[model samples]
Target: MATPAHLNRVALRGRGARSNATGRFETYRSESFDDGWTEADEAARPLTTIIQPMKSRTIIARNDSPDIGFNASINPYRGCEHGCIYCYARPAHAYLGLSPGLDFESRLFFKPEAGRLLERELSKPGYKPQVIHIGGDTDPYQPQEKSLRVTRAVIETLARFSHPFTIITKSALITRDLDVLGPLGKAGLVRAAVSVTTLDRKLARSMEPRAATPERRIDAIRQLAAAGVPVTVMFAPSIPSLNDHEMEAVLQRAAEAGATSAGYVALRLPLEIGDLFQHWLRTDHPDRAKRVMSLVRQMRGGAVNNSEWGQRMTGEGPVAEVMNQRFLIARRKSGLDAPSQRMDVGSFKVPARAGDQLTLF
Candidate 1:
């Protein structure tokens, strides 16, 4: 899908429908022509919907990185249905022989057994609990989750075992598991972070087409906070020229919406994401595309991305420093710099094996 040529004149509306594919999720684009009108039939050219399928195994994925918070994580599904053009995980689909463009959002994978596998792993005698991050690599609450409920099952298992975990997502669907997350938060076993890239509904639609509307995401934050869930707002992958300007506004709104803490990451276009994001910028925001790339290069030491551990997340140079400073100031002003309450791992309760029941006295 090409970025609209008149992005400056474009005003986004949240009226588009979801995709209809069997195994993936999608949101169709709704365009209004230059004449300031959209025909009735033109309003519904494409129908987007979520698709899902089951997977055989799901368990722990280990990553040793100084930059990331959690060393271990779990993804209930592969290929997020959110269809964010700037997603850093898009390249992953290439390994599956899928296009990082529309195909990435249209093709999906699910690990239905994730909850069972997590139980088995947590039950092992040698298993030690550390905060397990969900939606670390791909969103746990992508659209397909509505049907598969794999993510909810994982949360249920974690709740059952009192395992500590964190979920980061852009979808309001996270609200659906409030039954599980609410109590877990009270027990200090869970925290949830909602990603808000841009507050502008139009920008959000073009940038993260398949995720929930910005208003809905804020509502999710409010609901989580009301339920006693410690909620954090994440302005992740802050594309320099495109959405960077909204940093302070996003943080402020999140604070108003009950976000206690907030964080932001500079856009990192690693591997295929570089090409994919460039394609998106050119297609959607042509006027600012060059400037955006220039600023990204300035931050990345004259490259579109830097893969080094410490430098990758924040990047380098004047542009990055300015972004960091802006975020720090905004975060401090909004009273969002306070540390989040840590999830407790000591309270884990391991379930017994199937045949281990003892006779009642």
Candidate 2:
């Protein structure tokens, strides 16, 4: 448990801790320094989590952003417990009147009514079925999911309504819902993608705190495939000068684990994320911090990130092109370039509401 030079009192990371850096939004959007009780005292402070219930009116969210493929999505949680330092969704916490730093992960909000809301929306007249993307912002399968079961309830709703949906998660908890996903897969109403940032256990722990181990993720992929679910592997947000080198290896391992399709997104640092990530880089890998930022800027068009639709996911430069080319080549060679399995939209059928026909099918 080492501390940063400036944050000598604060722990930079825990075992598998990825977000030890101070929250940028905590400055009240300003900067101030205090030299209280040396570094030892700061490291002694403990980390705790507080879960709150969110009363959400709707479960289905419409997205017009051309950046993502899906139009609608459902996230059962407001914040994530997986404290991945590079989570692009971190800044969203600011909208909740909270800091996007540590608060984004430690302070979580769960939507208890997600399942009912989803069912109600599905019962609406003329409601067309689309592949509702789950885990859009915060991971619906995060640790809290085990106890709250909000995500499970949403999936159950989709299954009952014959709604097509997709899942994106880094947790192995999804395997627990094989009962739900298995049927959806057979009906062609569900697909899933698991994210593996790095195959290296140590790095994986450091980069994504609280997520299942890399081995567990691969095992989850195997389990999903065994259950006949269409599984894809995602090497999301490849960090420059760090896990980027492991792209080929990650693809190979995932393919071996029964993943038929794969995709990736270059690291994205919008708003407060840039500051939080830069601080982590300097603190953990100080020697390579400067070099990493340099490469990131080169790929991001002289900025730490690019929010442009076309350039945000994949940057526009020689370096970015190289990464993309490498990925495509690896995918092709690994037989991951096969046509992606599309969710069966035609199978979507509206189900009866509470008072409607008992046989909604």
Candidate number of the best lDDT:
2
Give the range of the ten consecutive residues with the poorest summed lDDT in model 1: 15-24
Q: lDDT by residue for model 1 over 1-361, one digit each (tens)? A: 3333232222222212121111112234243233546554554344233455656654789999999888989988888767787777777766665555555676678887888888888888888899999988789988778878899889999888889999999999998989889888888999999999888998898788779989999999999999989999999988887899999999999999888999889998887677667766776788999999999999998888899999998999888999999999999999899987767989987866579886597
Per-residue lDDT tens digits of candidate 2, residues 249-355? Answer: 98898899898899999999898788878877876688899999999999998998889998999998999999999999989987789997677888777765568
Clashes of each: 7, 1
Q: lDDT of candidate 2 vs native? A: 0.83
Clashing pairs in 1: 3-283, 3-284, 18-48, 18-49, 19-48, 19-49, 24-51
Q: What TM-score goes with each of the models?
A: 0.85, 0.91
Q: Show model 2 residue runs off by greater than 4 Å.
A: 1-43, 353-361
